[model samples]
Target: MTAIDWADYATGDKNAASRTLLMREFLRRAALWVDHLGGSERWPFFDIAERVDSSVRADPDLLERLDEFTNANVPEFIARRMCRAAVHWAELRESTEVTLPDLPDPYEPLIVLYERGGVFFVENGVADFEMRRVPLRTWQANLAPEPVVEIDQAVLDAANEEVH
Candidate 1:
């Protein structure tokens, strides 16, 4: 499908007819975008275009319908993004404050600390062997030791030989 230059709609006279046409166009584009993403199932996003089309055909007071839709408290973000408009939207009715669930910290498991002398430390098991050490004893003691595993010397030597 050909892309319509939405900027064209923004130009010209700012009358009721023009506004209605622009709103209808925006709703159509939003419906197409919704269909492109996935057909409406849980949410009836695509139905917006049909409803707006009906309103346009009926030549009703779009501003009143828009106010009603806005008062219903649908997400403004989705409309703003899909409609390609820079206009500020106002809600006619006051909306209740939404309480978001507290999110858990992703880095909670790792211990982060600074030594008294100013050396920083991380207590996670993972370590970089190539880390530079100014004080050898303190660094060695703090780093978790690699577990020893028994292996036949001859078999190990043969495996290393194959890799080389």
Candidate 2:
């Protein structure tokens, strides 16, 4: 009854295909439920929300940090938090609902496409590694490009040398 099964569709236009967020949640939750309970998994999103919300609330200390930074615990600090919480990785991050990253340059349609769960350059036939997850804070449904080119390495080096 699910629209897109993570185990089924390896790649697709998530934005174009998905009608509701529940469908996305269903995929991850079903996979987890299948591994945990059995019955090959059934309706999942509704079942898992309670557990997920409870788990997230139990750690309110990080609520502000997660809300503000979109990164509850960066890779560098996650290990320490996991050890402190005595929880594994899946339990640590509440939602697989990935955060979107800011595009490198707005003008680059390729970057926009990549961020919107679409890719033209790299064929993601094997994985739906949503590139938007790269920059969680920069959330915008539409692409508005403002391009800025960084100075050349030589100029950067000269500036650095003067400061040093």
Residue-level lDDT of model 2, residues 1-164, one tens digit each, is 01112132223334422211212222332344334333332232123323334343335564444433423322223212322332222242434553213222111221222233322111222122333222111112112232222223443334334533
Alpha-carbon error at 128 in model 2, in Å?
Answer: 20
Best by TM-score: 2
Alpha-carbon deviation at 30 in model 1, angstroms: 0.3
After superposition, candidate 2 runs with Cα above 4 Å error: 1-14, 18-32, 38-42, 46-58, 67-164
Which candidate should be chosen as best, given lDDT against the real structure? 2
Residue ranges of candidate 1 with Cα displaced over 4 Å: 1-14, 41-164
Root-mean-square deviation (CA) per prediction: 28.2, 19.1
lDDT by residue (1-164, candidate 1, tens digit) is: 01222223222222222222222233333334344434444231123223212222212365445445434432333332222111111111111332212321111111010000111111243211123111212222322222111123343334334534
Clashing pairs in 2: 100-135, 101-135, 106-145
For candidate 2, the lDDT comes to 0.28
Per-model TM-score, in order, reads 0.20, 0.21
What C-alpha lDDT values do all the predictions have?
0.25, 0.28
Worst 10 residues of 2 by lDDT: 134-143
